[model samples]
Each structure stands twice: as structure tokens, then as C-alpha cells.
Target: MTTQTPPVLALDVGGTKLAAGILTADDMLQQRAEVPTLAQEGSAEAILGRLIGLARDVIAAAPERPRAVGVASAGQIDPRQGDVVFATDNLPGWTGLALGRRLAEALDLPVFVENDVNAFALAEAQLGAGRGYHHQVLLAVGTGVGGGIVVDGKLYSGSMGRGGEIGHVCIVPGGRPCTCGQIGCLESYAGMRVMLPASGYPSLRALADDYLAGKSIPAVDEAAHWLGHGLAQAAHVLGPEVLLVGGSIGLLGERFLADVRLSYAVAAIKSYRNIPIVPTQLGADSGLLGAGVYARQRSGD
Candidate 1:
């Protein structure tokens, strides 16, 4: 007789929100709960307490108790130690946090932690858009742009787990300043924080809506163009089989993707120009699901 694997708890901590869910052995998510992060309003400890409370709420609604916990967080995470190596002001007081150890102790469960974008890439490669591909690149363009690289069907987290920081790649030398203390980085031009204000749209969704309605929004177009330029550079260095675009802005659908493709074609070398760029299949759940899957795989469960 075969024994069924137990469900695992998945947590995603972003600058704007905290989420928790129960992921079954079969990869289905249940009892999902979310709360605003309000990162700037309180100390990290208070935010952690809120996350812990969210986790407990989900666990209470789950059909079975989870055996382990996995966290996908916005930061440069040390996968080995499950701590934050670095973080931008988006997640205030997040750097150098011993996240895994704290969660493990609080819930009395083994825990694993990974950068949120890396987790998103893992989920896409394993079960979403990049499925069946051995190598791929994923770019997440939301509040801030981030990236993840998957080589040989596994996440290539680079030295100290800081690889795949494509958003920090310099696209325009001596241009706009970025949050990472760099000038002309892709995020400075393409991220929502910049695009939304520049486009005079109250939100990314509104900008996308206008673009989709045949309204020409110069800011959105400019962001897409720069994003494509960044992708082309990434492609030249890491010739992946495919590129997956995720996050809120990326999901602007075919119209925005067409613009990015046009820019990519112009910027990329001829040999690398044919690579397919597609939307992520899992939508908003990629990070949460990926964290759960990573925990299960790493724990040998």
C-alpha cells in the first residue's frame, strides 16, 4: 500500500500583501487567505506576527494539518539559511531577517524560504507555461521588476542566491535612477511604480485597459519597449528555450506583448530573435504554489 503525502503550508510575503494557503500533495491549493502587508506602518516583528496569524487561519480551514511550511518572500534570500540577505525599501526592515527560523519555531514545522520571483519561475517551469522545457527565463514586472532563471529544470540561484536579477541590468546608462542605487536599470523605466505615474494613470490596470481599448499610452509603450530591450540582453547571455512573463503589468495580454516582441526583435541578435515569449499560466498563484512544491521536493516528502 502506498502512503499519501501530507499537505504543506505555503506563504507568500510581498511588499503589498501577505498570503497563506494549504497545498495538497497533488498540488492543489486550498484555504487561501490574504492580508495587506502594511510594511511601513510597523516593525518587522509586527508584520511577522500578522503573517503568522494568517497562516494559522488557513491551517484552521484546511482539511488536514500541513507537515511543512514554505515561504516565498520579496528579497534576496539565502536559500541555505532561509534568511534575507538583502531587500529594498519595498519591504522595510526585511533585510537580514531570519525568516525561516522564526516561522519554523512559531509553527513547530520545518520551513523553507526562497526569493518570491525564483519561486514563481520554479512553478512556471514545473507546472505552468514553461512546462516541458528544461531551460527558461521568467521576468516579473509589477511594482518592481524581478527575474528568475531556470536551467536544466532546476532554479539556478547563483552564488549567495542572488542570481536572476534581470531588472537591475542597466538598459540606459546614466539615465533614470533605480531603487537599487543604479541608474538606467530596467526597473527604473519599466516597473509599475514608474510607468503608472508617468502614464498619468491611477493604476496599472487602468493603463492596460486604455492600451487594450486602442488608446495610445506613450508611457506604457515606452515601458514595454525598454522591457523588451532588457529581455533581449538577457536572451543574448542565457539562451533559454523560452521566456515567460508574469506579474500584473506583464499580464496586460497580447497587445502589450506584441509591443515587447517588436522591441525585442529590434534589439536582439538575429540568431536569438526567434525565442518565444509567453505569459505565465498560473497567474497570481505561481509564487504560493511554487513555495509549497519547493518545500515538498527539498524535504524529500
Candidate 2:
């Protein structure tokens, strides 16, 4: 009798980049490739065509043919129907896209679509920062802020599939507006887009440079404050055992981490006095890894 091969293939479709990889059961990538995402094409067909090209490249380099594919994209997805139901700020033409079915048809393999932040959280829970914890919260602060929750090692996508939207959590009641049409969302202030301007930088790497120059401390402090306020509210609701921070803002290191914790303590109710906050071990690749793992699990391989 012949033994069955393992399932592999993961793609991360981001606003700025598209990453594809072939993974093994051991949580390692067998092949990988990355390219820019030129989202100006303005339609799912165009974007997905580019993604399919990238996938083909990885498939060619893989040691063996992958049995399945998983995609982690920035948006709200209807898992039951495998549809991209809403647009995330990152990708412009993602709303109402039949991403799962389309990909499965094109690749001739099963495909899974998951929210990018949820994929990051799953990476943390199963292989990274939250590996040992059954319940954890992942906060991704980058071009925009996103969040994910893992309960008992399983992703809780909530009703409406927008439950982990921690970035949209109102902190200041009537402050800055978010792309999600909400005011006072934490993303309006703490996200990389917000911090870059405050730090007098034209880009994220420049902001990091400004921080190293010692002039961006105030900007960092401001980010931490907004993030803490939002997290305090999250603590009240999800109450995860650990809070794992990822994305561009997390690169701020110890200085911002301290302020985030301090502000959270003040904003949080008494019940969340001791929840641990830490950085994600999977870092930038968390989303990709999580997508692969989710696909493999769903495939039962």
C-alpha cells in the first residue's frame, strides 16, 4: 500500500506584498516566494491573477505537489460559505469576492480563506508566542490595527466574522475616525500610519530611524497609550490569558511595551490586573504560517 503525502501551500495576500510558500507537517516552509501587491488593478480578478502566478512559482519549487492551499488575507470572511464578505483597508477590491471557490477551481485543490489577523493569532497559539496557552489575544498594529482571539487553541471567529476587530474599539469616545467608519478607534491613533506622521517620518522605517535618534519617544508613547486603552476594553470582553503583540508597532520594543502596560492597567477593570502582554514569536511571517497550518488542519492531514 502507498502512504499518502502531506498537505501544503499557504499564501498571504497583504496590501503591500504577496507571499506564497509550501509548508510541511513540521511547521516549516519547503519553498517560498514574495512579491509586491499592486492593488491599483481594482478588481478581485486582477489581484487573484497575480496571486495565482505567485502560487504557481512556489508549486514549481516544491519538493512534491501540495494537496491543498490556504490563504490569509486582510478582511472579514464568511467561513461557512468561503467568501470574502467585507473589504479590509489593506486590499481595495476584496469585498464580495468568492476567493475560496475561485482558488480551489483554479488550483484543483481545496482552499481555505481566513482573516489575516486570525491567522497570526493561530500561529502564536499553535507555534509561536501563545504556544502553551489555550487562550490568547493577538494584536497586530501596522498600516492599520487588527486583532485575533484564540480560545482553547481554536479560533473564535464570532458571529458576523468581525469579532476580533480590536482596532475599531472606541477609546476616546469622539476622537479620530477609522476607515471602518467609526470614531475613536484605536487604529486611528496607534497604527503605523498614525505614528509615522507624529514621529516626523515619511515611512515606517524612517519612524524607526527617528526613534533611534531619540526624537520619536513622544510618538511611541502616544501609540502605546491608544493601544493600551483599546486593549483594556478587549480584556474586559475576551479576557485571554496572554496578549501577544505583532506587526510594525511591536518593533518599538521595551519602551513602548512599558507604556502600553501602564496605560492598560489604568484603563482596565479590576479583573484584568495581571494579564501578561508580550511580543509574537512568529513576527512578520505569523500570518503565512497560520494560513498553512489552518489549511493542513482542515484537510485532516
Best by lDDT: 1
lDDT at 298, model 1:
74
Model 2 lDDT tens row, 43-144: 667788889989988888887889889888887887655689987545877899988998898888899889888988888899998978998888898888
Residue-by-residue lDDT tens digits, candidate 1, 143-165 = 88999999998888987797899
- Shift in Å, residue 206, candidate 1: 2.3
Model 1, residue 155: C-alpha shift (Å): 1.4
Number of clashes found in candidate 2 = 0
Model 1: residues with Cα > 4 Å off, grouped in runs: none
Each model's Cα RMSD: 1.9, 2.4
**Model 2 Cα shift for residue 203 (angstroms):** 2.7
Q: Which runs of model 2 end up more than 4 angstroms from their true locations?
A: 1-5, 88-92, 212-216
